[model samples]
Target: MGTGNNRTITKTRRKIRDVDQIKADLLCARHLEQFKDSKRPEDLPGLGQNYCIECAKWFDTETTLKAHKRGKPHKRRVKQLREEPEPDPRRIPGAQTTSQSIGQCYDTQSAHVAHMEVDT
Candidate 1:
């Protein structure tokens, strides 16, 4: 029994494509590490020199970056990105190596459920 305008506004919201790309980067250990401390120039705002990998945002200056780091959102992200303590290797039943996983595919699927793997 309210104005339909509000409902339309909420339903029309669209997601940014970069969010998906950010997720992909966050999942890769090497990418996250490189982004965290790398001084490389990027296409992002401020060339990504002053950027927050967790929030996927850039700041204009180190002062602002420091301020953002103390903020609740950044603190939350820091906690979120903290790596989980690895289970002691000797505790596992049949674990092979102690080196941490790097998001590789689990295993090759059987032919019945997989497509032909051809070099093209």
Candidate 2:
């Protein structure tokens, strides 16, 4: 029982990390793809600064932009936005238990009499 429980926990952790990595990769790829397409020599679409790691955008003003990146509110918003919806645990495939069947007939005469009396 203990070994089975530990295996379940380890599997859950791996699954969680797999999901988080996919999300992070998705975000990173999205920005890189956009930046690759939108790149320009004279004027950048965002503001001409290197990719804002926090906002995932380019910025013009370094001081103000970096300040925004460093702010707690921005960090919180980024964190909130980065979080993907958790997978439904119920949907994950797992072993199913066999249901026991109670026969229609009573186990004994006394049990049947007791059940009938309770019903009455």
Candidate 3:
């Protein structure tokens, strides 16, 4: 019984290691692809100022911008924006069109709120 339990534990550890290795490989591949693509200047407007239009964020440096690109909140916001573009407060029924109201609309979203807090 002791030998059987030892073997089971060893097998489980091996499986975990294998999975971890596979994840590492995948991440490496992803980073390689990003690095290759990053050589070209982004077609998006406002390049040089470290502005992330998707998150409405401004990073202090290129290193911080690169790191922010890999972060969870930015990723989530990117995905969300891709799936559904931000609604125009003026176009929405019963929504106020003032700048304060429009800003409030953005603030209510979790991803925006998270990034805004981090900036401050």
Candidate 4:
């Protein structure tokens, strides 16, 4: 194989860029929305129309993508993603969150600052 061929490479498997792109995509509403029911581009592979969200992979066709979803690799990726903890959108800057999912708006910023004060 060539040293720099990208067509054969998967997104998460790429060496040059980290998986930060995937993380950023997760923050977007449209990213997760596609998982419910996917919509493809007419031009083909346009901005990764047939993308696998969990594995960060792109397929050229819907048939191939459906096949991938049935495969073990895609299932494993889905499992792995589910196991990872969901990041808090209300995360405080420079503060470690002490409260998680309190069923209401809880300020982690103040809690963290108070904790820091006690530590120092």
Query: Using lDDT as the measure, which candidate wins?
Result: 1
Summarize candidate 4's per-residue lDDT along 53-75 as a digit string, tens digits: 66766788789999999999878
Each candidate: what lDDT?
A: 0.59, 0.50, 0.49, 0.56
Q: TM-score for all predictions?
A: 0.39, 0.37, 0.31, 0.42
What is the per-residue lDDT of model 3 for residues 1-120, given as tens digits with 9 covering 90 to 100?
Answer: 344567778877544223223333333555334433554445433443575545644466778888989999878866755453456555756543332221222222255422222111
Please identify which of the two predictions, 1 or 2, would achieve the higher TM-score against the true structure.
1
Global Cα lDDT for candidate 3: 0.49
Candidates 1 and 3 compared: the better one by TM-score is 1
Clashing pairs in 1: none
- Clashing residue pairs found in predicted model 2: none
Q: Which pairs of residues collide in model 3?
A: none
TM-score of 3: 0.31
Instruction: Give me the displacement of residue 6 in model 1, in angstroms.
Output: 11
lDDT value, residue 93 of candidate 4: 55
Ten consecutive residues with minimal summed lDDT in candidate 3?
99-108
Per-candidate RMSD, Å: 11.2, 24.1, 17.8, 10.0
